[model samples]
Target: MTINKYPIIIISLILLSLNLQAAENYKKFDLPLDLINYMEISLEGKTAVMTVFAGDSSQSFRMESLEDNRSYHEISYQGSVVLNNEGFMSSGAGYPFDLIDKTDVVFDNKKTRILFYQKDPESDVKFRSRKKNNISIFNDINIAGGDFIRGSVVSFWADIVINGEVNEDVIAVYGDISVGQQAVIRGDVISIDGKVDIAKGATVYGRVQASGGKKKFQFDRWTRWHNKEKDFSTIIRFYYDRVDGATPLLGVQFTDEDSLLPNVEIYSGYAFSSEEWRYYVGLEQSFWLKHPITLGGSFYRKLATQDDWLMQRNDNTVFALLATEDYRDYYEAEGGYIFGRFTPLSYFNVEIGTLVEKYTWLDAHTDLWSMFGGSKAFGSNFGSVPAAERASGIEALDGAEMASIILKSDLDNSDREARFGQSFWMGTAELEWLPDGWNDDFDFTRYFVRAGRFQSLNEYSGFYIKAGYGGSDGLLPLHRRYFLGGLETLLGYRHKEYSGQEFWLGNVEYRLTFPKTDITGLLLYNAGQISEEAGKLGDAEVKQSIGIGVSFEESLRLDLSRRLDRSDSSFQIYVRLGINF
Candidate 1:
């Protein structure tokens, strides 16, 4: 074998010269790994033509193999061609010589690089003999900011980034995809190991799925309609609260649909609320036994100051006794019970529950009570009831007496040294009508009526007519049983001035918006009162206040109001975030 070294060298030199001339006549380009079996590469002028065989077994040329096997032939115009792992087919600037069978090809101006890989022509696998497979696997297709027109079927298991918008019908399978806020995906997105981030203002029209061990999926700042159905089997939130001159609080919440069982939920929290410190611990569970049917129970306990009670007192009392002594007392309330709900239709749901609650004051005094309530929604025919009407309602004599008597009886039986006296029960119901075409043009009108058996006071019934156009910025909660000046309903009036169970409240507001920022300006009028008790309806004094305000940062609001009832009208300012309710 070593005897012909001189002759072999001479033949190689001649073959290399001829090969160099042939290379100069034909151009070359890169080919992807997936298309290696059926791709033919050649060159003509400045254009590179890549013929990909789609019949069956495709043939591909590996640049490294060509260099090694054709050592005798010289490559006059030499360049590297890349063959991707999946072999979808790609090329550099090589002109195509010919195409065989029914195969389609497209040239991308944005992607200027092509790849080439090694292949054996004498192998038993023929180019047109292999069966066609629907799923085309790509080693890696990296689209930085260009368009990738997937022909029939192409799948990838890598990263794909679209700096701009991607048109429709582009299916990409990957471990992860990080889409910028400016990026738009017009087709389906599927991921197995990675998560997706649809940034604020981004849009995705197809379904998105993130399976396997990945977590922490977030959807932020989206503007158009979005539907997200995710299985959050593992998620938790920890919350802590501390305030000056008050108690410190801490709690954790677990939100998993199956944490407990099918249709069953368990929630627990603890906190302390006192003049010096306040705290509470609570737990709740909810279960869905059937469609439109649910059952739930909860237990809670809190240790807080007597001052906290003042916050829950009636607005009329708070305003009247503005200079009351601070009740630095400690109390705890804990209880649990079962409840059931029924929804016969989409617009309406009714719930019934039995709950037993025990309250202990100063760790020595205790009382117990029970509760029951039902809610329903009528069709749109009712002029939508504003938040004010829903919040404020006449306290019916029977309902008020029932609540007061229950608490008083519990305290008497608890062997606690406390005020033992007769109380009242008042039950009131209101019907709000918002006609289909109701608007601010006509003075918004509401009629209220209440009737009940007052234990201490006489059995009574009262009716009132409230009319106003706009007072959405008023301090008072319009829907409350009675309108009283405070941080909510009447901005400029003192909290104690308004007292009693029955009173009329009204507010009218006119809003203006800026053309550039779209911020809103508000002018409002608010007024209302409370009576001495459930029955006696006389000496009804009315207080009117006007306020001017603006809303910015969407919900942050600021308003200034002046009482119009007096000559030296008093004014008050309020700064708040979010809606009143």
Candidate 2:
């Protein structure tokens, strides 16, 4: 070692010089804390351009040359610029391009402050303009594909279409924003007095606000938004049933094209089996008082049922046509009803209505045919149990002129972010009254209360529970009574196997959805009791059933169920559509 001290000293100096030279090839910059998730930076040779977004506010800075060692200055470009690292070389580059590369670079945004590092040269940066890069007023702004904006974009009295990338906030006042599938935004998206429409696969790193698009209270699942952009549309409906056979209806609807006008519908159809003409005319008007209130009225002459809670009409139609299974009893109801619905909160609704109708008993047709169960006859419209064995309250339903008042309320607060399903609690309470001396064949006061809850166990599974009780105070008409059995009720028994003036039912279900698929597996338990006499609900024998099912797209379903309390009972299979609750 003592022989070559001069050479060792010379080598050490050279290595030190190389290390210092490498250090000069990198650059570091501080970013706003709030914009850690809402900022983008691109380098073009010696110039560095950056945009930072904070809620509705955004700022942009441009550095001319890294060799100049100057601070970033504000720029006038409000739109995005395309970023490219092509044509970048380590051999013949000037400032920033000579300093940075694709590798050995890290973007650290998780900290309170963001740090951007650029170090080698396989990645040169380029900014290309497809259009003018600035805010707009009275004219729509469009960002074409492959374009990138380094600053916030603002538009007034117009719309914005983004098919590219935005480095900061995007704001639309009195306008709308439409983000394409491939668009990427590194900042907040804000639409005032309009809607933010995001296509699938679009990415946004900050909050999205649609101030003008509010969720409306849906009266029922059939409620649909009429195309406001169109004048009107025609609707056609068709279904099969034991009483009506094949029923087809045509209708036209007018929506809220003008704020002062109400939504109106008129439809008429013919029932081939019943040989009767059916029609429904309805009008609904909404007003925003202390809360949103809807006033509506309908005049209808058609087949009706009290068992709509068991299955939806669309799902029941499928079962009736394919399986020769009609879970609901039918009656001819010609009536007019006026109702008022109030939404005191986003998740709470109260409705009050009065109806006058002439009721006539319906007889099931023997010629009704099914696809699977060929030539099978439908069951009696009255039910499985004999009228004589039922309570005295089971009065005849034919030729009864009745007037009734109903009050109903429901509360639903559900979590929409669950992966498998929703987690929430929902409850409904209803009371119907037909006071004595109303000059009608029916005189009864009835009440029903039901509650249900869903619990999301994890991303794949959920638990559901529901319970209901219904009872009458006076002579409930035969058609007004409760029936508990197969399908949505106690799956262990036949349809309408049990009937009563008072009844109680409960169900528990666990469901698991397959990852990345619309398929779901279900395990469920159902139990219920029905009493012939009012106030004697628990006196009847309790029937219990356990079932397993699989569903596709949460619609089409196949189920296998068996009685839990009876060993003599065999398994029952069910094919249906839609959710029961």
Candidate 3:
């Protein structure tokens, strides 16, 4: 045993070497918290520099050496100096610094503050400009308490906290904006890539905005002066979606200073299969700084296929049709609609509006089919049809005016953990009244309500449930009725397979996410019933489907679904470029 002691020592040394090699890949940093509040710290080799902003002047201090997170100020230059009672060191070699005058930066006249300083021969601390030592886009200045900024306060790459009044706009780019309750901003409050929180009683004379793209690095250097800065911004997004029938779409939005209100969007696309034009222009004015009224309007000139609903289909299901490549039938509606919203609280809102439209029905006439190679999917114009369907085509609508009213309650927290760990509740009811006149004989009333919720189960699992019911009264035309099937309702059934003046649908899904990855699996079930009358809704034949699928990074969606009631039913193929479940 004694003879083996030497061999054991050598083996222990080798094990320690391996452990060191594995742990040196990451760099460690430690600095005192008190030093960070006033000055920005940066690392230069093994040294750190603290740059502080005073009333109208700026100064830099070199931290040559550090022991733990404590700062020991030691001047490392010829003219280097240290404030004894203040514990401050100026080591920018050869740079003239007045110790007494710079002491105003921190206000404290006593006590050494900087952690440590040594002669950093690796670089001369004296002649080194703070540019490389730190980066700031503002002419640094700190206002005393109760300070009032009379003009627009603009700073880039800087965080601002407002305790006093800012008579004009306060714009902080690439930084966060904190508005204390006692603080008043007579103008807009905007933060490009950071959060903006206004205290409960804080009064913002203008709009407040706090939003950015997923990539926080997205920056715009369009304006140099805060006052000249435009209160509006434009964003363009390009993506391929299922609703577009695998077509890539170019969408653009114009948002005002406050992200919550007054916006415009315009979208248009050419269908690959439908071979037609689809376009939409929408405008909204909602959630004003001091008011809850919301005004909106839109004008659309596109091929709108009847999906067992609407004189045209412009509801949420419009998205479902866009993923389609070919549509068996469609109608044209070119007109405008105007609506106003009144929200009393975060939980509920009411909207009332009017729509005036002229409709044109595209039917499969005998000549139309024969002339087009006898393909029902081919339009008379040889254009690709939308990959959508309906049970039976309706007689051409008489083209009338209608009034619509809606009440909604939406409570969503899907952002809690970014995915399967959140809760949501949403309920909405819409009523459309087709009044007599407008040179049309169609007069009807249509109404519906939908609600859904998601319950987060731990970090890897989630449960979702949704239900809906729709009904129509009076001379409700076929196109204004409801339909069930497709992704929004019955996934395993064909689009618009069931149509009626009234309908009910429900969906449930269980989601499980793989640990430490974006991979997710889903178990989905869908069922729905449709009827001509509300009384018959309960007895309507039920169409059901069950499905299983997996998604990766939400970029690709693949699913296998089968009809539950059909003996000959086989798994259906549903592939979406964009994830929906």
Candidate 4:
């Protein structure tokens, strides 16, 4: 259902034209915040009244918090406005929509119409942050633009702009904040129920939080914070798997989180997967060289084997593999590498990294099932050329020195979820050298390509498709080979069920977001083929699955699927966070 938007737009324009009186001049009423619990509201001549319990001891403030020198909540009504079951809340129109339970507002005080939020229209979800503080904003405070001017702590109602250094927190309860690109904030910059545009390059020593979300022209701080730093910090993470046993990792990362600096990560990990321990140290520094270039390098001994790698999406999503721990893929590798990234344009990036390491293949399955597929001769992932042709068995080092190049282009214009309306492409070609001579049987050149696109069928619906291909010109060490058969590539199949030098996978999905309720429905299809070693791809057995899923607020998701390739396979289900990235 559509509402008349013109009237609301007019009301918004009128509100913007008026300089709102200080909340004090507007007849404030310290109304009880809990009255809404009973769906109750009472109004009188410019006054609203109700009962409420306050303080840790459930007593009135009476300035006790001030005397005790602590912050406290002062929630109340600014006008004698009456509230009904259809409560009212608004934002960006000289109104600070205090959030309690995200209740809806369904009316206009005047004959004006107001536009209510719809899930599809404002589908884009950027990084929004919240903090726990009892601070209250009351007056107007402005930090005038200047050259390196040191700022002080402030709270205000009128909008604010910071073009200089702020030594303290800046709070805007009823307005927005414009932080200049060069602005340096030593403390938080908070917009209480308002918007904030933090220009690119701005540095915030503390968090930038907003209660009613945020608007942006710069970096999606939340995305960078979580994706870059969080992922780096996960170097210390722990993993559990029946086959790998207990995997515990410990690490420390410096993402320049507290200042403008390069990122550094160091970590160590060990688990039963190979009963091997590894260590790593990495550093990345990004700067503008005509365009933007990130020069980074790392030295590490990490699990380069398929069995030890859980193969999670960069978005940190896990599917059917989370439920089934029967891992039948295994390998081992440890090395150090360095790389550089050059982003010549907004939508494109190219990178190169080189590593020298030792590769070893292991049995993912301790029993008989572990020894099948791939070469057909051994019925194991370590096949023909590498195993049969090698003087030593699979236990050998399989030494290799490799340089890799990766190119990626992304122009996904859709909201946070896997995205739609644009396409993203990434491909790689890597040449590995057998420094130990041609007899080492571990030299090969690998080529990989992956592309995806999201088509917006309408405001509330979209179609998404992903395609992947991987192949190696000579024998790639078992650890360096391609593997499919899980949520990331082929759904409903056993984790890493197929290990081969050449593999391809395809995925298609339709997503629909329900209006008003903020729920999304999804239908998914997956198919893939695996060639033991550059054999006939057209004849390779096809693996496929069909599934359906639902997502709430783009965070939680659940999928149920069935394998079409396996007749004896039962329904497979999964619960994971976010969409495929």
- lDDT leader: 2
What TM-score, over all chains together, does every model reach?
Answer: 0.36, 0.64, 0.51, 0.53
Count the clashes in each prediction.
Answer: 100, 11, 26, 2
- Residue 472 lDDT in candidate 4: 67
Q: Model 3 residue 264 lDDT?
A: 90
Ranking by lDDT, best first? 2, 3, 4, 1
| lDDT per residue (tens digit) for residues 1-581 in model 3 | 01223453465456445434433432211221211223333433335565544434657756564323232433332345532223344443222221111111111222222222221222222212211111123333233348776445544456777777776566654567787766666666666556776565455655565544542232121221132222344433332222223233456776554434468988876755335566779998754332255678999866555432221232222333343233234456777888766544334555566676676554432222122233333223112222232322233353533343323333332323243434556566776654434335465677778877766565577778888887776645545666666556777877556666788888898888798888889899988888866567788778889999887876666778888989998888666554232
Per-residue alpha-carbon lDDT of candidate 1 for residues 263-353, written as tens digits (9 for 90 to 100): 3233333332223333333334433211234445555544423232123323212221232212122234455555444433222333444
Query: In lDDT terms, how accurate is model 4?
Result: 0.50
- What is the overall TM-score of model 3 with all chains considered together? 0.51
Clashing residue pairs found in predicted model 4 = 372-379, 421-454
Instruction: Give the per-residue lDDT digits (tens) of candidate 2, residues 291-388.
Output: 44678999999898888888878888888888888877788999999987766555778777888898776677857888996878787676576867
Global Cα RMSD, each model:
29.3, 21.6, 22.0, 17.4
